[model samples]
Target chain A: MTELLKVTGLSRRFAGGGLFRKRKVFHAVSDVSFTLKRGQILGIVGESGCGKSTLARLVLRLIDASEGQVTFDGVDMASLPRRELRRLRQRMQLVFQDPYSAIDPRYSVRDALLEPFKVQGVKLGSPDEKVASLLDMVGLNTSLARSYPHQLSGGQKQRVGIARALALNPSLVVLDEPTASLDVSVQAQIVSLLERLRHELGLTYLFISHDLGLVRYFCDQVLVMYLGRVVEVMPSDAEPAHPYTRALLDSSFEPDPRQRRTITRLSGEVPSGYDLPAGCAFANRCPRVSDLCRGVLAPLSTLPNGQQVACHNPLIDAALPAACR
Target chain B: MLLTVDMLRIRFGAFSPVDQVTLGVDRGEILGVVGESGSGKSLTATAIMGLLPRIGGQVAGGSIRFDGTDLVDLPESQMRRLRGGRIALITQNPMTSLDPMMRIGPQIDQAARLHLGLGRSAARARSLDLMADLRIPDPASVYDLFPHQLSGGMKQRIVIAMALAGDPELLIADEPTTALDVTVQAQIVQILVDLVRQRGLGLILITHDMGVVAQACDRVAVMYCGRVVELARVDALFEHPRHPYTQALIRCIPRNGMARGTMTAIPGMVPTGMTQPPGCRFNPRCARVESRCRVDIPELLVGPSGNGVACHLAEAA
Candidate 1:
């Protein structure tokens, strides 16, 4: 299984209405398709309401997809029997964004890690030894085993979350903004820890974040999303092909003051996801918008540098040759 | 200088969360107070706004001098007049500061009416002018909209307009754009920067994000464990971070074009609550932790140019 996970034509719709009114279906995710290979980190970068979190849930089967197929390890998740699906779930894991709310308030760190094994109805020889090892693996002191979520710091709580996710030795781990709630120093620690863990365990990751600099630094490939659709996918070192991706890159402030640019801030608010635009979601704010962009949705097309873009007027600049780093 | 906070210390009974903070901001400058949670950055801002008493934090030592007036000895009655008149605060979440039941226009008008004592029509006219200045599209129509009707970015702009309504010389923004999206954050930050230049208002922006500090602030105070570890011009601070803590913090950020796998974390966790280490607060986590750092408290020593580092190693060298 060179390809650890393959998601095709994924679409998830959430119904919003009362009993007296007709159901208004909001497409939270639409036509999302991507393949994750072994030990590769695919970073999904987007703003809020971009369906990156929902896509993570859909991939893990924590929530059912309205329409799509998720094939993991040559097994179609939709076609799997109930018992088989339960067994297959052990291979994939999700590390939640919020360290505060992800863990149970009452459960000790040790208990929280062991709950997964108990829920799966398996005992890995010795529970105490396993807990100690898991804590050690995530670089947390074993003494913190008895500490509750409230007692741990944000960085420590995130470490507990990571240790819990690794308890089952899952092949694919989906880290949904794992460091968003952390401070910069702690975030760097978590990023470095994640990097080390991936190397030690040979784990594949789907790292989702709003920070483009971080995504570029950490991932092998970068996927840009906007209003529940994939806008661009490029190598982490490449210049983006989509206008929305360019806007995202521009909006992020660089740490060095020397590289400061006069930000011609993107005009127009992000259109509400409940009432999605008929054409390109970014047409309202795009500097290079044309009549064709406002009239029709662009299909995902590949460029010479292996970057994928879904835009009528993509900024396929000369930087393409240097993109294949 | 519009505001000068010298050796400011705040205590809650036996615990002192904010200690020995010293920083100043000029009328046309943006001073960024950056730190992690419990780093006392927000508390420093709150102390300046004279709202520390609301959170049961009392100023234990030092002076907060605004316009040559020491606010330390100022009575609550006079502090009230200066709170939203001469100085104003913009918090992170707009909803918490804004009344949901009130119209957005009236909310902006409230500040001008209360602080400037303008009539109903004049306050409203001033609100519309402020809204326009903030680049809100069709200010008249948006004025009638409720806080819930507007998007997150628009709500933040309304909040900014309200802060401007007071016509204050100093504005304290406590993580104002933390709740907004990145794209909208850029817009709001740009607006703030423009407002600072156009109006010559002293801005003390409190945040945890280093990138925002570099992009917006003229000078930055790097806080760690309730102290200003490094204070310098934004360029100098980034280019030559002297303090180990400051250096580690800058290193942690994932910079553009930086090679992969080179990032390293500081060794230990920040000292929490009253469990502060002796000597330098960052000694436990410092890569160059000497015996002196663990035994002696290093005070921030600024040069004549107003750039300083509170590190034993930097102080020695």
Candidate 2:
């Protein structure tokens, strides 16, 4: 598979403190590196304040990164000129969490779809025809184009949001918690729509969400983040070997009672981003934390079958799963 | 039964949001009220807490008996005494539910002071103990901190602490962990389940997540468009969901072994206040809907196993 995006050692640090006080440097996205192949969905799973959202922004160049390189389609996005970067934005798009807030209150469905084209400076053959076709592509009725966002259902509004993301025929879509606000049935519809669209349109997706079950089911590969670091990266179908990943998987409540598993409850809370520990960020909460784990940084190392894990003691052996091999 | 709600109907003026909902909770049991948005699960919970009037709702018809006391006709003064004393509510968003100006200690202590009628010192001690019970590290420090000062999980723990301070016989948690992350959500659910077991308090957990129901609840009531479509034990509900709505809900969630493109999406949107169907509310979206389902309203009927279903086709299942 051809590589669509390559990120190396990307990091973003935010400094906050009173004018005279000691400045606190928060390592939001610390030394994260990953590659996305064309037509592949890479899911980033993490809890709040884990910098999943920050990594998404850094990749799209929506926010400046403190360190590392973001090469999109072999072009370094950071060093690109302002005009060139704006032009490059047409190839990458984002769908935010809340459909209600992501869209303009005053703009109609047609206007919302058309707004993307106008901003991207892409001239369509016919704006009306394009808008209606966009609505149809996302499974919305053509008649609803004239309606405001408030008049539409949550699912319909999200369809509109998806349509707007696809307005410029972008190759990569960064969907940040797209289904988090919608109802489960609606979430199902949206997930199905995204899957179909990705296949039909040959699009790559960077799906950032807190829902582990959905990520495992939908993503081609999963990247588990903890406290601004990539703790585990595995094939979607493979069982994770990191304790943090296992804890996250165990934490998710499955719908089937027969498959009910006890949650490996992690003691203590997520540490403050500003005052992160000197060792591994997740050492305090890791079930297998030892003296060495608490004092030394755990390096992300590749296993035999290419699944990368960052832990002193991995759950599964290096003998890879058959499917992954 | 610690609390029994029989055919409880909640109406906002002419539009009824909760219609003919019947469910009960036993001491030390967690009854999950599961549904989507606008499914009226929250309304039913608030109705039980005698809080429907606050949201411009009234108990149109039905009986809410708390240990044999009919709460429907009870006067406001009497209801006020019952609320926060025997029945406490835990709302969805702790950030919004909690007062930003007040410290966590005072906010939690106030519940004990009012409901338990404890002295200032007693309330403080009780609140701190509740916080500790919730596994909030450094309860003493957290007591003095503001709501904003704590994390989302910490804030929710404080909310749970306040709810427990009343020593309520029934705790109504409406989407308690919806705002929390998965790891934190697990912690909160564990805390709630432990509380139910220890205190033997009847818990009405209102959530849109079937996963939570499977993990935490003893029994489950599936709601759709203001109606209890199915009610059964959590294990039975997942194993053999009778109602079409309940079946569809189970199919929609991404289970562990589910493959891509296998997660079925229930077609058609949930009916609203204006477009509500005359007969079976879920018939339009139900895959097993029959001709009779389109015109006849299904009553909540009990099966041989004591499980209930409100569907014309449920008899065959």
Q: Give the DockQ (2 decimals) of all models.
A: 0.85, 0.80
- lDDT of predicted model 1: 0.90
Candidate 2 C-alpha error for residue B140, in Å: 3.4
- Model 2 over residues B1-317: C-alpha lDDT tens digits? 89988888888988888897989999999999999988899889888878788889999999999988999998989988888778888888997669999888999998789987899999999888888888888888988998889888889889888888888999999999998888889888988998999989999999998899999999989999999999899998988888889888889999887899999999989888767898899988988888998899999986665579998887643
lDDT of all the models against the reference? Answer: 0.90, 0.89
Candidate 1 docking category?
Answer: high
What tens-digit string does per-residue lDDT give for candidate 1 at B209-302?
Answer: 8889999999999999999999999998999888989888888888888878988777778889879998999998999999999999899887
- Worst 10-residue lDDT window for candidate 2 chain B reads B299-308
Error of 2 at A216 (Å): 0.1
